[model samples]
Target: MITLNNKKPVNIYDPAYDKLFENLQGNILKGHGRNFTSHIFLRFEENKKDKVKKWIASFANEITSCKKQIKENLAFKRDRTSGDTFIGFYISALGYSFLENFNSSEKETDFFGSMKDANISDIKPSDWESGFREDIHAMILVADDNLMLLREKEISIRKEMNGKCKIVKIENGNVIRNEDGAGVEHFGYADGISQPLFFSDEIQELETKYKDVKINFSSFFPLSQVLVEDPFLKNEEAFGSYLVFRKLEQDVDGFKAKEEKIASIVGRKTDDEKEEIGAIIVGRFEDGTPHILSHEEGIIDNLSNNFLHKNSSNGKCLFLNHIQATNQRDEASREMIMARRGIPYGIFPGEGREVGLLFMSFQSDIKKQFEATQIQANHYKDLIIGQNLPQKMNLDCFGKKGKEINVENFVKLRGGEYFFAPSIPYLKNV
Candidate 1:
């Protein structure tokens, strides 16, 4: 098992790791921290692999490195101003097949088999949106805090693609904020709270902020959790991480309505008490408070990364809750955790508006990490986001038991694809 610690810090810029960080892509070690993002899915035109390679080589200069990202992050911390637009490039298995003379056998087996062919969980490719059903060879992610600047960047990418590549689909994602000014999903719950910490400063900040709490779960992870060798790059420093992108459409009104029903079934009367029902279903209150930590919401000191589900059988937090099903806080569960960097997209509460989360995660092995977690969630019937059919869950809330309520769908799998975020050096040399 991997040991978890808070004493040691992973200094990415240290002499031993500086070269690796220089070759690694941004948003793998740390997020780009941009508010607006656009994912441009592309397919190379027939007989245009040479032009596509040239475009990729030229665009390699625009890719952000982890070293540069960390410097920008520190500068942002010192001053409120953020750096310029951040960009990321990823290629799918089909993209690799299109480019000649590229060796992909060194990659994980799942990379060669696209997400559409993976048959993950209960997701059906036929049900997916048309845009994702088509072949997507590559994706370009452009992000910036300013929407206008983000649009300009997208336009520039489209213009640069010319006839060499066809833009199959474009997904625009904007960060949705809650009343507390933190990022939240369409269901109004704080998201991305329990991400794996890779850097020394990140670990330090988490430890210092939650020093008083007894942290049962550890968020600290080594670089091996996400980094894998890039087959196309000969340098040992060249590494990359597999990326999983899924578009999950949430039914906000349906979920809230079910929450109300669950609240009434659990015998809660007050609004605050009723809210706890939602927390139980989600494994966290809307304000990001872990349900196992405290019954009430907004306990700022309750470290999200410091809770375990060992007592879940006692009914403090339902076994079928989203968090518990996805992560039971066990030694083996730690290996399955992914560095989630998703952002909510589209407007909510408006008629004819389609809103949901643009889920994105980085991992070393898709099958062992993302797919395993999803399969576990399916078995447990995760009430929030599990793609399984409607099923009943034992609602043992507030010391009550023997009550089973059928939980319906709240999230739909719209579309997704798996791609590899390769090293900047690999792209430049391709």
Candidate 2:
């Protein structure tokens, strides 16, 4: 119900919203980046309920203004560094139950359901390195330019929580920003390219009125598409959003090995030619260039949002191509895509550096947005990708060179959980 328009509701940065803002955490309203990120998952002791509440209250000051988070600190310490790097707090459904009130059995998303139902509990014991298959209560994400600084802050936080909570698992993720094949995922394709535009008038203005490829925001997104309304407060305007955290382990070596085989099958010999073949499968070049009308020649900007498959000829990006397979702009699904906030993760990052994405996304409804996309990516299936093809339910035209592009399950879903980041006001009351 909360919608932003020509009439500004209230600036999200206003001091009056201190309580509400503090309740919301980082990477909810905006995008998050990388350098060095340490993910520490936790499980709280049942006896220390009061202590846990006190610890949550301690974040009151840090969560507001949120100034010194990873991004700001990165700028200040561009040359120097801060021992007190940015910290983000997130909780699983079980953790929320540990809080006072507001834990009345949430079933909004399968993410909050029993772990077994999530199918995450079935991950092989060896893949336990990804963590969280067992019952995980909370997650803390700390990022910094200096690894020492990051570790120091993490150790201090742990020291405070000491006996009250136990560290379930700790994983360190390094950055691969601008290092040759940087900005590219382990699969060697541009990753995190097509994120949804946050629905603000200022942002919408830039995309719609003044731009050449006018975006019909209403057609694509509902007002509350990604906005989280405060269920605790009576005047529940927009408050917080849903966070979907998934640890996707990418098979860099396997993907590369498969790409070469696919290249030969399609007759691409040279490196550049093989790369293009990979992109066709991925839906974009390593630089994030979507290959829709790019082959059509006059259109397809690097930052293009104008291209929709229905407008293109029959089979521009074959029905099963990664990019084409993912694009769902129909009235039912235009708003289903969540805003991606994942960063590439690994100790030593790169094409085959044992890397993967710390896949994260935010949305109003996890079931509608994140789950919808997950369904399509789970398999090429019979999912529709328009190219003026016949309206048959079973997409007969979905393949590469008249043969189905064998989808290599390159990404493994090691672990994940859903959390509702309530508004600061709601948290203050709690």
Candidate 3:
């Protein structure tokens, strides 16, 4: 990760370590959806803090051989093939409470405290599921291509930590890919489109279409871009990062019906047109092509993600679209975006389908990285139609999708937790 005279990596990414300042948990920057994923949240019994620490030491030891997961993860991405299981450990705010050494902040910047503010979203921290609503000690993320293997690992892990800690909830997840192998969420839109490009010794080219901008590893990103070094780490100097977990329940049918109904009034006579209307609201064409750059010639390359919002003239791309609203065009937005590793989960049978996304991400700061985006997505109902005075865009109106539009909330937060996964060396000492 040599700093070039021009501010880009001169040649290639340095070795992963020399490139990434922090020893990141390998799974943080990995691709989405190979096969199976299980998110397990736990709570330690009172007076058993020592035992829980010992259990983590043991769990960390069990996955010692997997520290090279960064290498394996990239290989799988390159081959589009399934790799071995990838594991990561994280601890929640409540988990930090049990630690006598931690000096937890009571400020609104803290995720747990912000959740209680109510201004963050309609949902409150108290509304979360049992373990996540309160004293969640830790989270164990198990990912693999084999569902059976994941299940076995989950069981074995529980057996190992049984009395030391207890399982509060587990959301099983997997990549919902199409026949052609394009990743998508349960809502049928292309997923995993947004990722930051890094100029490193290893990263040679843009990995995804959505990542139109690349920053030198030494410039903005490092261990600092992905993790908090102090307080969260026992050694304050080793590798470890903050994790944000969100259980988003998607109203799949509701969203589709709304889209079709809205598109119908726009005189949409074909499925393509209706889908296009949906794309306008989503700010993309389901194939991960941004509406701001989509054309009859097909998806645009370099301009697909016009980071400058240069083409957003005459309300061409409404501020209401999910991507448009959340993908802020301001230069300051660079810090708001983070690498998202989301997985779709749920059954597909019956009238009342119970499927959604297990949205997870890593960031340098929750407030700046994830929360800022969330705030932008939730608000911004006023649309500045071209040069017109700011006004609300009526959803029922045809062609208003291009106006200042704040799309309705299609996903509800169920439960989640904030955690810090420390370095292997620090964990052993803990």
Candidate 4:
């Protein structure tokens, strides 16, 4: 039994690890797909660079010891929708102090300095502004079984490392922690629903559109903009996408109060039944399933219900729904859909502002998937957006059903930026 820092040995042969070990010839097995739970956000103290690296190395070592187990679990499928056992880790940009100086509207800043020389002919007009501010470093984990077990392992790894890493916050279920209950950012509307899917054909098509241009796929592989000889080689590379990890602190009590008021205005039966009210407003449940499809045709599966007979005329989700607002519901028309591969982070703080999603997604187009979501948020109740389009200026987010519900500044952009998650080979070798 291999172990690291006294942690229990993970079993690769266990049914939970099939996906990871699926192609390992005859020697190994894989894991199953399970819910990713027990998120911990560790913020390192400024000037503790060495300590941070050491802690990360030790934690990585512990995870590496379980490679054999990871390879043998049947639950390791890349796109497992059910209870799959999996573990993931990726360093984010949050540990840096330079990120604090970025202004949301600033055209120039230290963080986005690298992007200035970039030839961005391939990017859409709407996405030009989002290419700034590389803040909020992050790591991700997914597992098949209990969240507590995962949390326990994380704590052990951190403790054994003995570094300056402090538990800045923790949470579960889409940025909202257990403590805050129903109040959080990207909570009820099925956050990360309208992400962009990767297609090689699109890459080639993109090349034709912009000769000698590099298109950055956040969570996928092939980090460079240069096209490879064989496109399939790109597939052989990483998933060919990028992941966005965000740590947003939610205004819990405030959100709950607002939601209650919205429900009452919508004539909801009770406050506890706000999920239903939310579903009506967003057209989808909290778990990424469409309430309209769920009750309309008895479609209960979350994933299937999300895509089946989705309404795209005015957007698959409601105008107020976060995902719809983000993507503008142009998915069905353009065959665009982004897969969200992230979860909530931080334990809901009963008092202070500390809770939100670890928030990551694999998308081909950040603007189509990520930026779209932000625009939708602003459309709903973004203070920044509201401030820009004040009521005195005849600004409004809702129409008929929405006019009754006063959405006053709920979502806020703490900070973020575009990042490139290289493939395994690029990550290790390049």
Alpha-carbon runs more than 4 Å astray in model 1: 1-8, 101-112, 300-302, 311-314, 394-404
TM-score of 2: 0.78
Off by over 4 Å in 2: 1-23, 64-84, 101-116, 119-130, 179-182, 199-223, 232-238, 295-301, 347-353, 379-407, 425-429
Go through the candidates in order and give each one's C-alpha lDDT: 0.82, 0.59, 0.63, 0.39
User: 142-251, model 4: which lDDT tens digit per residue?
Assistant: 34356677667666655653556555444455244223242333444444433331223333544555454333222122212111111112323222233454444445
Q: Compute the lDDT of residue 263 as modeled in candidate 4.
A: 57
- Candidates in order, TM-scores: namely 0.93, 0.78, 0.82, 0.50
Question: Considering lDDT, which of the candidate structures 2 and 3 is the better prediction for this target?
Answer: 3
Ranking according to TM-score, highest score first? 1, 3, 2, 4
What residue runs in model 3 are displaced by over 4 Å at the alpha carbon? 1-23, 64-67, 74-82, 101-103, 106-118, 199-203, 207-223, 230-237, 295-307, 347-350, 382-408
> What CA root-mean-square deviation does each model show from the true structure?
2.9, 5.8, 5.3, 12.7
Q: Residue-wise lDDT of candidate 1 within 1-430, one digit each (tens)?
A: 1222324567756787777778889998788999999999998898877888898999999998988888889899999778889999998888887874444455446365488877556577888988898988898999999999999988998999998899888999999898779899999888888888888888788778878776666678878788888866778778899999988888888888887887787778899998887887788988888888788987755565566788544447466688888888888889899989888889775567888989899999888899999888887778666777556666665446888777687888889898999999989989
Could you say which candidate leads in TM-score? 1
lDDT of 3 at 10: 29
Compare candidates 3 and 4 on TM-score and give the better one. 3
Please name the candidate that would achieve the greatest lDDT relative to the true structure.
Answer: 1
